[model samples]
Target: MMGTIQNRDKFLNQIASRFNRPRISSPIGKPNWKSQPQYEVYKGATQDELLEILKEQCKKIHTNFVTTDLKDLPVVVNDVVIDFGGGPIVTWKDERFSQWGLDSLMKQEWPEQNIDVFEWDYTVGNENIHKAEHANVGITISEITLAESGTVVLLSDQDKGRTVSFLPATSIMLIPKSTIVPRMTQAAVKLREIHQRTGHVASCINFITGPSNSADIELNLVVGVHGPVKVTYIVINDL
Candidate 1:
């Protein structure tokens, strides 16, 4: 045991040498994220301007975007689902979707197109979860949107399943305009504060920028190699 300890310490010292540091240094400043200047440019922006920046940034990353009013949400969602070629769809089980009329709209549109739509159920979710992965379209709610990076944050928990985004061929995130943040740093700060207050985080907090891509095979570019090839953000402007 004494010899093992010496070897471990020697290995760590060698690794630190590459960085030209003998030991780790204590972090500086208050734990408060306000001390960090990473997102000040965005956190200080006007709401309207932030929305515009989000749209522009999303386009740059090849994410399709659409703005709709509260009443028009169902219509827009239906359009996106249809455009993705009408296949099996996986969606949320939350009743809040009914409040938005998304549930009824999907029922009406999917059946007419001869497509099957499944809602995520936590109690019996494990056995059938794999089926959701090959769904033609996946619709889920987003907690936050980072405008500068065109990223949408999906905070998954018991009620919200992770497969809603990872398993689908096309992923559609439903977000409200109010959830949009100016930058990723601002989002990170908010998340840290939430964890400090609650003492726990959900199962996952997904930061999705765009569709999955890779250039590993033959040095050729490929999209959707690991996940969805097409991603759409449906921002409810009046939310």
Candidate 2:
């Protein structure tokens, strides 16, 4: 056993030395996302104008996509099952909760509402979380963002859990427009900050844009095989 351990250590050090590993350079300066075709820049002389512009731009992405302040989210989402088992864990006393009023929103509100609450952990979720897949829409908060690709990032960590984003047919992300940056490089920097502050690296990090789509069937496009078929992002902003 001792000999095996020594050999393993030697081999590891040899591999590490051969590669001349160096610390990754910190991201600096502006991001390259401005060059992407999908990126849209919406700004106004006033913050209120920016909010309206962003709403219109976001609505154009899909018919089902709706941009409303969290306060405007209907008390009841009709005909949809929502699961909050492994979503974000914000302060119980925060104003953020007032917008969605999630704790107050009840499954009983919908005649056909199905709601399941699950534990937030690293393993596969319980039956309640899995049952969330039957619902047409799923909502969750983002852990980070990749500005260049217009991608929302989720890490399998404590506050922002993973399962909530992957299981539903339609995923709705409530992102604050202020968090938006210019590129993926800036995103990496933000992630590093999270790691440094939290001292925990996420097991899985997902970068999702739009819906779960594929074009693998002899030149035909398909969607929603492994994840949500439709992805709608509601860019929430304060004007």
Q: Which candidate is the best by lDDT?
A: 1
Tens-digit lDDT track of model 1 for 1-239:
35434577677778899999885656767675546577457667877888899989987777899989889998898899889987788887776688887766777767777888888878885743776776889888877888888899988877678888888889999888888888877898879987999898988889988888787989987777766889999998754
What lDDT does the true structure give each of the candidates?
0.82, 0.53
Question: lDDT (0-100) at residue 33 of candidate 2?
Answer: 67
Task: Show the lowest summed lDDT stretch of 10 residues, model 1.
Answer: 1-10
The clash numbers for all candidates, in the given order, read: 0, 2
lDDT digits (tens) for residues 51-94 of candidate 2: 44434444443313345565655432322233323222211122
Which predicted model would earn the best TM-score? 1
Error of 2 at 148 (Å): 3.3
Report the Cα lDDT for residue 5, model 2.
44
Candidates in order: C-alpha RMSD to true structure: 5.3, 7.7
